[model samples]
Target: ALAVGVAAAALLGFAVALTVTGLDGPEARRAAAPPGPAAAGAASRPAGAPDTDPDGAGTLREGDSGPAVSELQQRLLRVPDVYRDGATDGHYDAVLRAAVARFQLWYGIRGDESGVYGDDTRRDLESRTVR
Candidate 1:
């Protein structure tokens, strides 16, 4: 329990530092690399449904299943404010929606950030992924 808390705190601290210091710096990109196929400066879309969203991240929403949701949760967890354990269960539940809202608010991607996981949200969220 202690280890988990410590790790979470450290990650959150690092996240805050990155946000405050500006991710435009190369060091921030290497430090927060998200799991994906893309390389540096490239889009990290998880590769799923068609590119309906302007950001082309995807168009998943609540009740959706599979790897995309899992990926989204994993990225949300990195934000630190999501703060929900077991987020990568591959279920688009309420917990995920709330987290998505937080992410949307953080990135200013409004419209339907209510766990809808639409293209706009996906685009903003996907940009955070470390491919």
Candidate 2:
């Protein structure tokens, strides 16, 4: 019984060490890469749905107000922890900007600035959510 227990412990330790080493591999590094221009082009949208940002500007920043901003807020709410306040009043305020930044950071999207909503952020969010 003692020898069996020791062998099991050694096996568990070896497995943990292997996992720790694997975390430094290329795939792990890519998965953990920070949001930036380099990460922006990593994902490609599949065919079928038209691109979300048709106008191509995809610029939604603070102080803007209207249905579009409201829609953006609604979408952000769909992402867990991205927009916790759940306010969709069509106003682009600090809260909304922070939520957008959080979403970008979480998803490794960096085509636009931290708080600004640009094509990359729009595409990534749209890809992850339903209409």
Candidate 3:
């Protein structure tokens, strides 16, 4: 009787092990990028936050002008490493928030969505750009 009980316990343990092992899938293992500060909180930051470029030195190129997003910027919206969601239509909305989060995550900066791309974010973007 005791032997039968031990065998049943072993079988149960093996089944459980198999079940747990089988649960590993692409969805389960999606390598989520590190999270940034909450978007809502970051957006309303005080005027004089710790900024990289307070003087507005980094001007957007021809396509980067206006609230309208550029193609390159749109491409950035798709990069998983960049952490944006949905389309990059140049409006500084949630997608841009995610992009800023990605930028902050990559550069190890404290996330603050001041809407102005600071020197650190710009520098990191410049360094990572593929010519």
Q: What is the C-alpha lDDT of each candidate?
A: 0.73, 0.81, 0.54
What CA RMSD would candidate 1 show? 21.0
Clashing pairs in 2: none
Residue 43's lDDT in candidate 2: 47
Best candidate (score: TM-score)? 2
Q: lDDT per residue, candidate 3, 25-122, as tens digits?
A: 55334322233566545666776775333424553322244443454465465456674445545555555555665666766754234333555655
Per-residue error (Å), model 1, residue 30: 61
> For candidate 3, what is the lDDT?
0.54
Which of the two candidates, 1 or 2, achieves a greater lDDT against the reference? Answer: 2
Model 2 regions more than 4 Å off = 1-56
Task: Give all TM-scores, in the order shown.
Answer: 0.51, 0.56, 0.39
Q: What is the lDDT of candidate 1?
A: 0.73
Winner of 1 and 3 under TM-score: 1
The residue ranges of model 1 lying beyond 4 angstroms of the native Cα positions read 1-57, 111-113
How far does residue 21 in candidate 3 sit from its true spot (Å)? Answer: 84
Go through the candidates in order and give the clash count of each: 1, 0, 2
Q: lDDT per residue, candidate 1, 1-131, as tens digits?
A: 99999999999998998899877678888778874553532454455634445433567777888998888888888776653574688888777877887777777887664657887776666687766
Off by over 4 Å in 3: 1-55, 59-68, 110-116
